[model samples]
Target: MLKYIRPYLLWTLLSPAFMLLEVFMDLLQPQLMSRIIDVGVKNSDTAYIVRTCIIMGLVALTGVVGGVGNMIFSTKASYGFAKDLRSDVYRKIQSFSFANIDNFKTGSLVTRTTNDITQIQNAFSTCIRMLIRSPFLFIGGIVMVCTISWDLALVVICAIPVLALFVWFLLTKGRPLFMGMQQKMDRVNTVMQENLAGIRVIKAFGRSDFEKQKFKTANDDLCNASLKAMRMMSLSFPAINLIMNVTMILMYTFGGKMVFNGALKPGQIMAFSNYVMQILFSLTMSSFMLMFLSRAGVSVKRVNEVLNTQPDVSDGTNRDAQVTQGMVEFKDVSFRYPNSGGDPVLRHISFTAAPGETVAILGATGSGKSTLVNLIPRLYDVSEGEILVDGINVKEYELNALRGGIGVALQESVLFTGTIDENLHWGDDSASDAVIKEAAEIAQAAPFVSRLTDGYETALGQRGVNLSGGQKQRLCIARALVKHPRILILDDSTSAVDLSTEAKIQTGLREVFGDMTVFIIAQRISSVMDADRILLLDNGEIIDTGTHNELKQRCAIYREIVSSQLGEEALKA
Candidate 1:
């Protein structure tokens, strides 16, 4: 808990000052009450009674001022802490490698950043304010009680053991229950998140009933865990209350006898009773604050675990030799996902692409085609070998310099909620209107974009959900083209576009990108048939490499794929 709160130390320190002022005000009221009862009410003096009543009212007003000041400091600190902590977590998440991201359940990450932070905030608000209040009242109450009668103060101390025992039980039994509750919340979040993301798949498969049952089990487990924690907490509160009531009753009987014997004045006995009650009240408050800290302790540990994970890919700053040209080479690069103890994704691979050449990789799914391209941008480190650009190992180049040379259209395209121009500007922020228009036209995206009511300024829904898959692909292509990167990678980006549009895009790409290097990964043989070089990959190895005519005569796998996709009549025609 301290780790999460440490960042906001300046405000936290300021927060206690206001609380101390509030405690001083509270102390004044109790002292004034005793004086009013003993000197004013019992002495038949109207002037003294009126004066003391006014003093008590002034103390209450001071308490109000202290409360307002405390709120100002606490709200500013808690909100600032929440905002900065969220930004820190989000930036840390972006640094994680693909393998590290896969280790976490998506829902768990969401819950930790959101719900868990709220829990910590609530604990902060309660603990800091009440923490000072409890301790001040306890100490002040003891001093006041001793002034009134030392004998009665000793009696109150006798009940201290009971309060200590109750608090001990709460801490011992409730901590584990709260920890289990947090884990249960994670499971609940996992099921809910999975269902939300895969709702379309669930509906398509007609598995509504099965999904409902799974959700029910997760929800019930969370409910049971929460109930168990509440039960343990309930026992502590009632036992403390019982001890407080019994202690008060014994004080009343003993003090009443002493009052009748004239050994104690009526005002002093009343003061003694108030002091004893205040002491017990502080003890009860301290117990509650301690309970909340236990829960926050668990939450802080989980949050810290995510923050402490070292990213597999490190950003290399101060890279002197940036990849100036589009030249790329791979020297026996290989990778195996940590969870899967199988063969590496790419084995004994060696390749080089000169500037101004089009290289195409054709393979079935899971042939490591995407993984191969991912290494170019240094998204993941190679297991055993090195990848180089411009004659320098990729790892030696800064991340910004290495990625700046390339523009990638991934297999899964994403768009933010903004006008079309805003999305396009992400590739190159200073692009002129003319460059955006030219790039959009070259990608064959202008026709549909022009049909929209607002054209280039048209607002898009999140993920471009309103656009057709083909239109979204074309926009992604245009965004990539606008940057004029030295190397462009299209990872099956044109699969959704019609053949006519695809041909037009290819023709346009040839004219403006004359000396640029392009790496095209496609399942369609037609997509890569015209490439300067074609490489057929299977099971992490390149099975064949040749031009279109050369592969048709010598490679059986290329021939079979061509025959199956286009058919004998289509191929012959």
Candidate 2:
């Protein structure tokens, strides 16, 4: 947090400097008013009164200048700090591995980046202005009040401890509630995001009532948490005012007698009252600033948790290793999610994929086929054994150099809101028009894309909602193809496409990228029927490995799957 302030040091310093000027001007005005009342009016000197009034006006103008300058510089410093902090937080999140992301969850990270950072920024802005001004005014007022009448200053002195103690009590009680409030806000945001993103599903299934209830529950929790925190803070204002009023009453009671005895003049007693109010006002401002700081303490810890976290995955020792040939091998690889603390999701998986060969993995819904392919790109590191790419251990290659050579179209077809051409550029930003169209054609996306009024320049809705499922999937495949990667992994990428279109895509892939290593994870037997080799996975282990024909001849599970999907007559053939 201090490091973010370093860049804006000039503005941070200037804000408080101007605040000091303003406080000084404020302190001067009370004395000038005392002189006008005691000397000018007492002697009936109109000239002195006019002169003092003009001087007070000039002092007010100076204070205004100071306040404006303070606002400008403080805003600059605080906003600049927030910008840098948010950028660094976002960058850190981008570097996180799958395991790291799973730990934080998407909704919680979003809240920390937005609401949490904003809380700290506002606290910083207030500190440079009010925090700097309050203490100076409080001490300055006390000194001036003492000079006017030492006896009256004693009233202010007594009230200070009571106010200080009450503020401390409220702050101490409020800290944990504020932390809990922030967590509840995260829950509300998570529910809202899920509702918006899955609105189509909710509507299609007629579950809108259920989703509404879910959001209401989260919203009510946030409201209750916020009310608890605010209720504690609200006790401060009335208690502070009561103490202030009582002290003022005591001041006038004692000072009036001093005036009657000629120990202090009436004009001096008036100045004394003004200084007492100033002192109490400063305390009130300080109380509010302390509250802000207390809440900010919680925000600071939440933000630092992200910054100080060492990513589960870091850069490898061999930072310069790049893949020349797509040769991937898994040597008895096994993995389980770090946070799950259960059996390995993938167990004893061993396979070798050579350049120019196509290997397919077939499995049940939870057979870990996708997990096996994911390790090749190091999305999640294997808990046991090793994975090698081009004969070099994957853990020894720089993450960027290793991932850059492989193009993956995941099981989920995610598309951004942009022109089709821009989305394709995500794979290879420098790819030319011809290369993009070629890739689109190979993925069987070009014909539908061409039918659009703007062709490849058609603008899409958020997450490509304007397109059909098959259309989005084909575009994802084309985006991966645009990379012209040495290796390609399509994890159920063509599930939404028709069988004929899927066949054409498979044919086009072989024609254009014959030498690229391809791994296909599919449930449909026909999808892998022509592959060079197929591995049938059951649970977390491979039950059979062979070409389609060999598996049909020797493996009972493979024969059952073939009979179910392709028919018993087709299997006999």
Candidate 3:
């Protein structure tokens, strides 16, 4: 926070400087009025009254100019600080590894970036505008009143300790509630995001009522927490006002007697009352500033949590090691999810995929098939062993260089809202339109794409909602193909396409990408039947390794899968 403030230090300092000028002008006006009443009106001196009026008018104009300057500088400093902080936070999040993202849920991160940052921004603006002005006004008012009459000033001094204690108590109690309110806000955002993303599922399953109830619960929790925090802060105003009113009554009662005794003038009593009001008003503003500070403190802590987190995966220094062959090997590799405190997802796994070879992995769900291939691209680091690409340890290669050589299409195909051409450009930004069309044709997506009115220029909805599951998968595959990476990993990416179309895609890929190493994870036996080798994974270990025929004869798990998908006669054949 201080680092960001350092850049705008001039604006920050100027705001308070001008604010002090405005407050000084404000303090002088009451004294001028007292002199006009006590000296000029009483003595019937028209020239004295006229001269003081002109001076007062000039002072008022100066105060107005000071106020405008204060507002301009404060706005610039606070808004600039927020912009810098938001950019730094977003950049930090972009650098986070999958493990770091898992630690902070998507909804929570969104809340911190948007709502939390906004809260802090508002508080900073208020601090610059009011935090400085109020304290100065309060102290200045006290000094002015004391000079007028020390006897009456003692009344304000007596009320100060009591009001200060009460305000302190309320602020202490409200801080924890404000913290809880922020957490509740995160819950509400999480529920809202989940509801929107899965609205189709909720409607399809006829569970709208269930989702509504869940949202209501989260929304109510936030409402209650917010009300509690606000309610605690509300007590500050009435308490301060009551003390202020009582002090004023005491001042009038004591000073009226002094005036009757000819010891104090009536005009001086009026000015003393006005100065007391200024002190109370400044104290009231300070109390409200404290409330804003408490909430902003919570937001500051949340933002720092993300900014301070160091990414678990850092880029390696060896940028010169290029992955030319696409040969990947895992040597006694083992991995478990961060903080899972359970068995490894892949246990002492080892395999080698030579360049240009097509290897298929077959497994039941949760068999760590995707995890095994994920290691190749260094999406995650292995817990116990080293993974090598092109005969160099993956950790030794720079992250961009390592990942750039491999193209991955995950099981859940995701697409952003953009033109089909733009989405494909993500794979190879320099690719020509002809190359993109050819990649789409190779993925068996040309037929449907050509039927659309706009063809490749068609716009997609969020997550490509306008397209069918099979269409989305084909587009993702086409995007990967456009990269023409040396290593391609398709993790059940073709599951949504029909068997015939899947076969066409496989054939096209093998024909066009024959020189690229391919790792295909699939449940369908037919998908891997023609592969150069098949790996049968059960649990976290590879149970068998061979061609389709060899696995059918040697592995019972493979035989069972074949018999289930095809008939018993077909397996016997």
* Each prediction's RMSD to truth: 2.4, 1.2, 1.6
Candidate 3 residue pairs in clash (backbone atoms < 3 Å): none
Off by over 4 Å in 1: 1-10, 341-343, 568-573
Per-residue lDDT over 124-149 for candidate 2, one digit per residue giving the tens place of the 0 to 100 score: 99999998799999999999998988
Compared with the true structure, what per-residue lDDT tens digits does model 3 show for residues 292-407? 98889999999999999999887888979888888988899999988677999998888898999899999999999998998888777789999989999998888889888899
Q: In candidate 2, how many Å is residue 370 off?
A: 1.5
Candidate lDDT values, in order: 0.84, 0.93, 0.90
Winner on TM-score between 1 and 2 is 2
> Model 3: residues >4 Å from true position, as ranges?
none
TM-score of each: 0.93, 0.98, 0.97
Clashes per candidate (backbone, < 3 Å): 0, 0, 0
Candidate 1 per-residue lDDT, tens place, 1-573, comes to 456578778777777778878878876776788788888888888899899899888888888888788777787778877777777888888888787787877778887888777777777877667777788888988888888778777778889887888798889888899889988898889999899877878999999899999999999999999999999898877798899999888888888888899888888887788778889989998898888888887777777878998987776755686666788888987777766788788887788888878899999899999988888887778887898887888888778888888888888888889999999887899999999998899889999999999999999987887888989998999998998888889889899998889888888888889788889988888889878888889988888888877888888888889899888764454
lDDT of 3 at 440: 94
Between candidates 1 and 2, the lDDT winner = 2
lDDT of 1: 0.84
